[model samples]
Target: MTQSSSEEEEDKVEEDKVEEEKGEVEEEAEEKEHEEVEEEAEEKEDEEVDEAEEEEDEAEEEEDVVEEEAEEEDEEVDEAEEEEDKAEEEEDKAEEEDDRE
Candidate 1:
Protein backbone atom coordinates (compact mmCIF):
# COMPACT_ATOMS: atom_id res chain seq x y z
CA MET A 1 0.00 0.00 0.00
CA THR A 2 2.85 2.37 0.76
CA GLN A 3 4.37 1.80 -2.65
CA SER A 4 1.04 2.48 -4.29
CA SER A 5 0.68 5.73 -2.32
CA SER A 6 4.17 6.87 -3.41
CA GLU A 7 3.33 6.29 -7.07
CA GLU A 8 0.12 8.27 -6.79
CA GLU A 9 1.98 11.20 -5.22
CA GLU A 10 4.42 11.25 -8.10
CA ASP A 11 1.63 11.29 -10.63
CA LYS A 12 -0.08 14.22 -8.88
CA VAL A 13 3.18 16.23 -8.95
CA GLU A 14 3.58 15.68 -12.67
CA GLU A 15 0.01 16.80 -13.33
CA ASP A 16 0.56 20.00 -11.33
CA LYS A 17 3.73 20.81 -13.24
CA VAL A 18 1.89 20.43 -16.59
CA GLU A 19 -0.87 22.75 -15.43
CA GLU A 20 1.65 25.43 -14.44
CA GLU A 21 3.40 25.29 -17.83
CA LYS A 22 0.09 25.51 -19.68
CA GLY A 23 -0.89 28.63 -17.70
CA GLU A 24 2.42 30.30 -18.53
CA VAL A 25 2.04 29.61 -22.26
CA GLU A 26 -1.48 31.10 -22.24
CA GLU A 27 -0.21 34.28 -20.56
CA GLU A 28 2.55 34.75 -23.10
CA ALA A 29 0.12 34.38 -26.01
CA GLU A 30 -2.19 36.98 -24.48
CA GLU A 31 0.67 39.48 -24.08
CA LYS A 32 1.71 39.04 -27.74
CA GLU A 33 -1.82 39.63 -28.93
CA HIS A 34 -2.08 42.82 -26.90
CA GLU A 35 1.13 44.18 -28.38
CA GLU A 36 -0.07 43.50 -31.93
CA VAL A 37 -3.33 45.32 -31.31
CA GLU A 38 -1.46 48.41 -30.03
CA GLU A 39 0.79 48.46 -33.09
CA GLU A 40 -2.18 48.39 -35.47
CA ALA A 41 -3.83 51.25 -33.64
CA GLU A 42 -0.70 53.37 -33.93
CA GLU A 43 -0.44 52.70 -37.66
CA LYS A 44 -4.01 53.77 -38.22
CA GLU A 45 -3.43 57.01 -36.36
CA ASP A 46 -0.37 57.80 -38.44
CA GLU A 47 -2.31 57.27 -41.64
CA GLU A 48 -5.00 59.65 -40.51
CA VAL A 49 -2.43 62.34 -39.80
CA ASP A 50 -0.94 61.98 -43.25
CA GLU A 51 -4.33 62.30 -44.90
CA ALA A 52 -5.10 65.47 -43.02
CA GLU A 53 -1.84 67.08 -44.07
CA GLU A 54 -2.49 66.31 -47.71
CA GLU A 55 -5.90 67.90 -47.54
CA GLU A 56 -4.43 71.04 -46.03
CA ASP A 57 -1.93 71.33 -48.84
CA GLU A 58 -4.66 71.02 -51.45
CA ALA A 59 -6.71 73.75 -49.81
CA GLU A 60 -3.76 76.13 -49.82
CA GLU A 61 -3.21 75.54 -53.53
CA GLU A 62 -6.84 76.35 -54.27
CA GLU A 63 -6.58 79.60 -52.34
CA ASP A 64 -3.53 80.64 -54.36
CA VAL A 65 -5.40 80.05 -57.61
CA VAL A 66 -8.31 82.20 -56.45
CA GLU A 67 -5.99 85.07 -55.54
CA GLU A 68 -4.28 85.00 -58.92
CA GLU A 69 -7.64 85.19 -60.71
CA ALA A 70 -8.64 88.23 -58.65
CA GLU A 71 -5.40 90.04 -59.51
CA GLU A 72 -6.00 89.46 -63.24
CA GLU A 73 -9.50 90.94 -62.97
CA ASP A 74 -8.15 94.06 -61.32
CA GLU A 75 -5.59 94.53 -64.09
CA GLU A 76 -8.33 94.30 -66.77
CA VAL A 77 -10.40 96.96 -65.02
CA ASP A 78 -7.41 99.33 -64.89
CA GLU A 79 -6.77 98.91 -68.58
CA ALA A 80 -10.41 99.75 -69.42
CA GLU A 81 -10.22 102.96 -67.37
CA GLU A 82 -7.07 104.09 -69.15
CA GLU A 83 -8.73 103.66 -72.55
CA GLU A 84 -11.70 105.79 -71.50
CA ASP A 85 -9.37 108.61 -70.37
CA LYS A 86 -7.59 108.65 -73.74
CA ALA A 87 -10.88 108.91 -75.58
CA GLU A 88 -11.95 111.92 -73.52
CA GLU A 89 -8.65 113.69 -74.16
CA GLU A 90 -9.00 113.30 -77.93
CA GLU A 91 -12.55 114.78 -77.86
CA ASP A 92 -11.35 117.84 -75.89
CA LYS A 93 -8.53 118.50 -78.35
CA ALA A 94 -10.93 118.37 -81.33
CA GLU A 95 -13.34 120.83 -79.69
CA GLU A 96 -10.57 123.30 -78.97
CA GLU A 97 -9.43 123.28 -82.60
CA ASP A 98 -12.99 123.89 -83.84
CA ASP A 99 -13.39 126.96 -81.58
CA ARG A 100 -10.16 128.46 -82.93
CA GLU A 101 -11.30 127.90 -86.50
Candidate 2:
Protein backbone atom coordinates (compact mmCIF):
# COMPACT_ATOMS: atom_id res chain seq x y z
CA MET A 1 0.00 0.00 0.00
CA THR A 2 2.82 2.41 0.77
CA GLN A 3 4.44 1.88 -2.65
CA SER A 4 1.11 2.36 -4.41
CA SER A 5 0.56 5.68 -2.62
CA SER A 6 4.00 6.90 -3.73
CA GLU A 7 3.23 5.94 -7.33
CA GLU A 8 -0.07 7.83 -7.18
CA GLU A 9 1.66 10.92 -5.86
CA GLU A 10 4.13 10.82 -8.75
CA ASP A 11 1.28 10.46 -11.24
CA LYS A 12 -0.51 13.51 -9.71
CA VAL A 13 2.64 15.62 -10.01
CA GLU A 14 2.98 14.77 -13.69
CA GLU A 15 -0.62 15.66 -14.29
CA ASP A 16 -0.10 19.07 -12.65
CA LYS A 17 2.92 19.75 -14.87
CA VAL A 18 0.94 18.90 -18.00
CA GLU A 19 -1.88 21.21 -16.91
CA GLU A 20 0.61 24.05 -16.28
CA GLU A 21 2.16 23.57 -19.75
CA LYS A 22 -1.25 23.69 -21.39
CA GLY A 23 -2.13 26.85 -19.50
CA GLU A 24 1.08 28.51 -20.64
CA VAL A 25 0.35 27.63 -24.29
CA GLU A 26 -3.16 29.08 -24.02
CA GLU A 27 -1.85 32.27 -22.47
CA GLU A 28 0.72 32.65 -25.27
CA ALA A 29 -1.96 32.20 -27.92
CA GLU A 30 -4.17 34.83 -26.29
CA GLU A 31 -1.26 37.26 -26.16
CA LYS A 32 -0.57 36.71 -29.88
CA GLU A 33 -4.20 37.36 -30.72
CA HIS A 34 -4.20 40.59 -28.73
CA GLU A 35 -1.07 41.78 -30.53
CA GLU A 36 -2.66 41.01 -33.89
CA VAL A 37 -5.74 43.07 -32.98
CA GLU A 38 -3.60 46.04 -31.96
CA GLU A 39 -1.65 45.89 -35.22
CA GLU A 40 -4.82 45.90 -37.28
CA ALA A 41 -6.18 48.88 -35.41
CA GLU A 42 -2.96 50.81 -35.98
CA GLU A 43 -2.98 50.00 -39.68
CA LYS A 44 -6.55 51.22 -39.99
CA GLU A 45 -5.65 54.46 -38.28
CA ASP A 46 -2.73 54.99 -40.64
CA GLU A 47 -4.93 54.45 -43.64
CA GLU A 48 -7.42 57.04 -42.39
CA VAL A 49 -4.65 59.57 -41.95
CA ASP A 50 -3.43 58.96 -45.47
CA GLU A 51 -6.91 59.46 -46.83
CA ALA A 52 -7.27 62.74 -44.99
CA GLU A 53 -3.99 63.98 -46.38
CA GLU A 54 -5.07 63.10 -49.87
CA GLU A 55 -8.30 65.04 -49.41
CA GLU A 56 -6.39 68.08 -48.24
CA ASP A 57 -4.11 67.87 -51.23
CA GLU A 58 -7.04 67.70 -53.60
CA ALA A 59 -8.73 70.67 -51.96
CA GLU A 60 -5.59 72.76 -52.27
CA GLU A 61 -5.29 71.90 -55.95
CA GLU A 62 -8.88 72.93 -56.60
CA GLU A 63 -8.34 76.24 -54.83
CA ASP A 64 -5.30 76.95 -56.95
CA VAL A 65 -7.29 76.30 -60.09
CA VAL A 66 -10.06 78.65 -59.00
CA GLU A 67 -7.58 81.42 -58.22
CA GLU A 68 -6.03 81.02 -61.67
CA GLU A 69 -9.44 81.34 -63.31
CA ALA A 70 -10.26 84.50 -61.35
CA GLU A 71 -6.96 86.05 -62.46
CA GLU A 72 -7.66 85.21 -66.10
CA GLU A 73 -11.12 86.85 -65.87
CA ASP A 74 -9.62 90.02 -64.40
CA GLU A 75 -7.09 90.13 -67.20
CA GLU A 76 -9.82 89.80 -69.82
CA VAL A 77 -11.78 92.69 -68.26
CA ASP A 78 -8.68 94.91 -68.36
CA GLU A 79 -8.10 94.10 -72.02
CA ALA A 80 -11.70 94.98 -72.89
CA GLU A 81 -11.44 98.28 -71.06
CA GLU A 82 -8.22 99.13 -72.94
CA GLU A 83 -9.90 98.45 -76.27
CA GLU A 84 -12.88 100.67 -75.37
CA ASP A 85 -10.57 103.51 -74.37
CA LYS A 86 -8.71 103.29 -77.71
CA ALA A 87 -11.99 103.39 -79.65
CA GLU A 88 -13.16 106.51 -77.75
CA GLU A 89 -9.85 108.24 -78.50
CA GLU A 90 -10.16 107.52 -82.24
CA GLU A 91 -13.73 108.92 -82.36
CA ASP A 92 -12.62 112.09 -80.59
CA LYS A 93 -9.77 112.58 -83.06
CA ALA A 94 -12.10 112.12 -86.06
CA GLU A 95 -14.59 114.71 -84.67
CA GLU A 96 -11.78 117.21 -84.06
CA GLU A 97 -10.53 116.80 -87.69
CA ASP A 98 -14.05 117.35 -89.07
CA ASP A 99 -14.44 120.56 -87.04
CA ARG A 100 -11.00 121.75 -88.29
CA GLU A 101 -12.05 121.06 -91.92
Candidate 3:
Protein backbone atom coordinates (compact mmCIF):
# COMPACT_ATOMS: atom_id res chain seq x y z
CA MET A 1 0.00 0.00 0.00
CA THR A 2 2.86 2.43 0.83
CA GLN A 3 4.59 1.78 -2.49
CA SER A 4 1.39 2.55 -4.41
CA SER A 5 1.00 5.87 -2.64
CA SER A 6 4.60 6.85 -3.45
CA GLU A 7 4.06 6.03 -7.13
CA GLU A 8 0.98 8.24 -7.25
CA GLU A 9 2.93 11.17 -5.86
CA GLU A 10 5.63 10.71 -8.48
CA ASP A 11 3.00 10.69 -11.19
CA LYS A 12 1.57 13.96 -9.95
CA VAL A 13 5.02 15.61 -9.98
CA GLU A 14 5.57 14.55 -13.57
CA GLU A 15 2.23 15.97 -14.62
CA ASP A 16 3.02 19.30 -13.00
CA LYS A 17 6.38 19.53 -14.82
CA VAL A 18 4.68 18.88 -18.17
CA GLU A 19 2.13 21.56 -17.55
CA GLU A 20 4.87 24.11 -16.67
CA GLU A 21 6.76 23.32 -19.85
CA LYS A 22 3.64 23.91 -21.93
CA GLY A 23 3.02 27.23 -20.26
CA GLU A 24 6.58 28.40 -21.08
CA VAL A 25 6.17 27.40 -24.71
CA GLU A 26 2.91 29.34 -24.99
CA GLU A 27 4.51 32.46 -23.50
CA GLU A 28 7.39 32.25 -26.02
CA ALA A 29 4.96 31.99 -28.92
CA GLU A 30 3.03 35.05 -27.77
CA GLU A 31 6.22 37.10 -27.49
CA LYS A 32 7.28 36.09 -31.00
CA GLU A 33 3.91 37.13 -32.41
CA HIS A 34 4.12 40.54 -30.72
CA GLU A 35 7.61 41.19 -32.13
CA GLU A 36 6.47 40.28 -35.62
CA VAL A 37 3.58 42.74 -35.43
CA GLU A 38 5.89 45.58 -34.37
CA GLU A 39 8.30 44.83 -37.20
CA GLU A 40 5.51 44.88 -39.77
CA ALA A 41 4.26 48.23 -38.52
CA GLU A 42 7.76 49.75 -38.78
CA GLU A 43 8.18 48.47 -42.32
CA LYS A 44 4.89 50.02 -43.35
CA GLU A 45 5.91 53.40 -41.95
CA ASP A 46 9.20 53.30 -43.82
CA GLU A 47 7.43 52.64 -47.11
CA GLU A 48 5.14 55.59 -46.55
CA VAL A 49 8.11 57.90 -45.95
CA ASP A 50 9.75 56.69 -49.15
CA GLU A 51 6.61 57.40 -51.13
CA ALA A 52 6.41 60.95 -49.78
CA GLU A 53 10.00 61.64 -50.72
CA GLU A 54 9.41 60.39 -54.23
CA GLU A 55 6.48 62.76 -54.64
CA GLU A 56 8.55 65.73 -53.47
CA ASP A 57 11.32 64.88 -55.92
CA GLU A 58 8.83 64.69 -58.78
CA ALA A 59 7.43 68.12 -57.90
CA GLU A 60 10.89 69.67 -57.82
CA GLU A 61 11.71 68.18 -61.22
CA GLU A 62 8.55 69.68 -62.70
CA GLU A 63 9.44 73.12 -61.35
CA ASP A 64 12.87 72.90 -62.92
CA VAL A 65 11.34 72.12 -66.30
CA VAL A 66 9.06 75.18 -66.10
CA GLU A 67 11.94 77.47 -65.19
CA GLU A 68 14.01 76.15 -68.10
CA GLU A 69 11.16 76.83 -70.54
CA ALA A 70 10.85 80.42 -69.30
CA GLU A 71 14.57 81.02 -69.85
CA GLU A 72 14.29 79.74 -73.43
CA GLU A 73 11.42 82.16 -74.17
CA ASP A 74 13.42 85.12 -72.83
CA GLU A 75 16.35 84.20 -75.06
CA GLU A 76 14.07 84.13 -78.11
CA VAL A 77 12.71 87.61 -77.36
CA ASP A 78 16.22 89.05 -76.94
CA GLU A 79 17.29 87.60 -80.29
CA ALA A 80 14.29 89.16 -82.02
CA GLU A 81 15.04 92.62 -80.56
CA GLU A 82 18.67 92.50 -81.69
CA GLU A 83 17.65 91.69 -85.25
CA GLU A 84 15.32 94.73 -85.37
CA ASP A 85 18.10 97.04 -84.11
CA LYS A 86 20.46 95.83 -86.82
CA ALA A 87 17.84 96.52 -89.51
CA GLU A 88 17.32 100.12 -88.27
CA GLU A 89 21.10 100.80 -88.32
CA GLU A 90 21.43 99.57 -91.89
CA GLU A 91 18.53 101.75 -93.07
CA ASP A 92 20.04 104.91 -91.52
CA LYS A 93 23.42 104.24 -93.19
CA ALA A 94 21.73 103.82 -96.60
CA GLU A 95 19.85 107.13 -96.24
CA GLU A 96 23.06 108.99 -95.29
CA GLU A 97 24.87 107.63 -98.38
CA ASP A 98 22.04 108.80 -100.67
CA ASP A 99 22.09 112.33 -99.16
CA ARG A 100 25.83 112.60 -99.84
CA GLU A 101 25.26 111.75 -103.48
Candidate 4:
Protein backbone atom coordinates (compact mmCIF):
# COMPACT_ATOMS: atom_id res chain seq x y z
CA MET A 1 0.00 0.00 0.00
CA THR A 2 2.86 2.41 0.63
CA GLN A 3 4.37 1.80 -2.80
CA SER A 4 1.04 2.44 -4.49
CA SER A 5 0.64 5.77 -2.68
CA SER A 6 4.13 6.89 -3.72
CA GLU A 7 3.39 6.04 -7.34
CA GLU A 8 0.14 7.95 -7.25
CA GLU A 9 1.84 10.99 -5.78
CA GLU A 10 4.48 10.95 -8.50
CA ASP A 11 1.76 10.74 -11.17
CA LYS A 12 -0.06 13.73 -9.65
CA VAL A 13 3.12 15.77 -9.70
CA GLU A 14 3.68 15.01 -13.36
CA GLU A 15 0.11 15.99 -14.15
CA ASP A 16 0.58 19.29 -12.44
CA LYS A 17 3.77 19.96 -14.40
CA VAL A 18 2.00 19.16 -17.68
CA GLU A 19 -0.80 21.60 -16.81
CA GLU A 20 1.73 24.32 -16.07
CA GLU A 21 3.50 23.71 -19.36
CA LYS A 22 0.21 23.89 -21.23
CA GLY A 23 -0.58 27.22 -19.59
CA GLU A 24 2.77 28.60 -20.58
CA VAL A 25 2.36 27.47 -24.17
CA GLU A 26 -1.11 29.05 -24.33
CA GLU A 27 0.23 32.33 -22.97
CA GLU A 28 3.04 32.39 -25.54
CA ALA A 29 0.61 31.73 -28.39
CA GLU A 30 -1.64 34.54 -27.17
CA GLU A 31 1.27 36.96 -27.05
CA LYS A 32 2.31 36.06 -30.59
CA GLU A 33 -1.24 36.54 -31.87
CA HIS A 34 -1.50 39.92 -30.19
CA GLU A 35 1.77 41.03 -31.75
CA GLU A 36 0.55 39.96 -35.18
CA VAL A 37 -2.69 41.89 -34.71
CA GLU A 38 -0.83 45.03 -33.65
CA GLU A 39 1.47 44.84 -36.66
CA GLU A 40 -1.46 44.46 -39.02
CA ALA A 41 -3.22 47.42 -37.45
CA GLU A 42 -0.15 49.57 -37.86
CA GLU A 43 0.19 48.59 -41.50
CA LYS A 44 -3.44 49.45 -42.15
CA GLU A 45 -3.02 52.82 -40.49
CA ASP A 46 -0.02 53.59 -42.64
CA GLU A 47 -1.94 52.74 -45.78
CA GLU A 48 -4.77 55.04 -44.75
CA VAL A 49 -2.38 57.87 -44.12
CA ASP A 50 -0.79 57.40 -47.53
CA GLU A 51 -4.15 57.40 -49.22
CA ALA A 52 -5.17 60.58 -47.44
CA GLU A 53 -2.02 62.34 -48.53
CA GLU A 54 -2.56 61.31 -52.11
CA GLU A 55 -6.11 62.61 -52.02
CA GLU A 56 -4.96 65.90 -50.59
CA ASP A 57 -2.37 66.26 -53.33
CA GLU A 58 -4.97 65.60 -55.96
CA ALA A 59 -7.30 68.19 -54.44
CA GLU A 60 -4.58 70.80 -54.41
CA GLU A 61 -3.80 70.13 -58.04
CA GLU A 62 -7.46 70.55 -58.98
CA GLU A 63 -7.65 73.84 -57.13
CA ASP A 64 -4.61 75.13 -58.97
CA VAL A 65 -6.13 74.23 -62.33
CA VAL A 66 -9.37 75.99 -61.39
CA GLU A 67 -7.52 79.11 -60.35
CA GLU A 68 -5.60 79.17 -63.64
CA GLU A 69 -8.83 78.90 -65.60
CA ALA A 70 -10.40 81.72 -63.64
CA GLU A 71 -7.41 83.97 -64.33
CA GLU A 72 -7.62 83.24 -68.05
CA GLU A 73 -11.30 84.07 -68.07
CA ASP A 74 -10.67 87.36 -66.29
CA GLU A 75 -8.08 88.35 -68.92
CA GLU A 76 -10.52 87.61 -71.73
CA VAL A 77 -13.20 89.74 -70.11
CA ASP A 78 -10.82 92.66 -69.75
CA GLU A 79 -9.83 92.42 -73.39
CA ALA A 80 -13.46 92.48 -74.50
CA GLU A 81 -14.16 95.55 -72.46
CA GLU A 82 -11.19 97.38 -73.99
CA GLU A 83 -12.34 96.58 -77.50
CA GLU A 84 -15.83 97.92 -76.78
CA ASP A 85 -14.44 101.21 -75.47
CA LYS A 86 -12.23 101.67 -78.53
CA ALA A 87 -15.18 101.16 -80.87
CA GLU A 88 -17.21 103.81 -79.04
CA GLU A 89 -14.36 106.31 -79.28
CA GLU A 90 -14.02 105.74 -83.03
CA GLU A 91 -17.77 106.27 -83.56
CA ASP A 92 -17.61 109.62 -81.71
CA LYS A 93 -14.70 110.79 -83.86
CA ALA A 94 -16.57 109.87 -87.05
CA GLU A 95 -19.59 111.95 -85.96
CA GLU A 96 -17.35 114.96 -85.20
CA GLU A 97 -15.71 114.72 -88.66
CA ASP A 98 -19.14 114.65 -90.36
CA ASP A 99 -20.26 117.79 -88.50
CA ARG A 100 -17.01 119.62 -89.44
CA GLU A 101 -17.49 118.72 -93.15
lDDT of each: 0.95, 0.99, 0.96, 0.99
**Candidate closest to the true structure, highest lDDT:** 2
lDDT per residue as tens, model 2, 56-98: 9999999999999999999999999999999999999999999
Query: How do the candidates rank by lDDT, highest first?
Result: 2, 4, 3, 1
What stretches of model 1 exceed 4 Å from their correct place?
Answer: none
User: Candidate 1's error at 64, in angstroms?
Assistant: 1.0
lDDT tens digits, residue span 14-90, model 4: 99999999999999999999999999999999999999999999999999999999999999999999999999999
Better structure of 3 and 4 per lDDT: 4
- Candidate 3, TM-score vs. the true structure? 0.69
Ranking by TM-score: 2, 4, 1, 3
Best by TM-score: 2
lDDT of 2 at 53: 100
TM-score, predicted candidate 4 vs. hidden true structure: 0.82
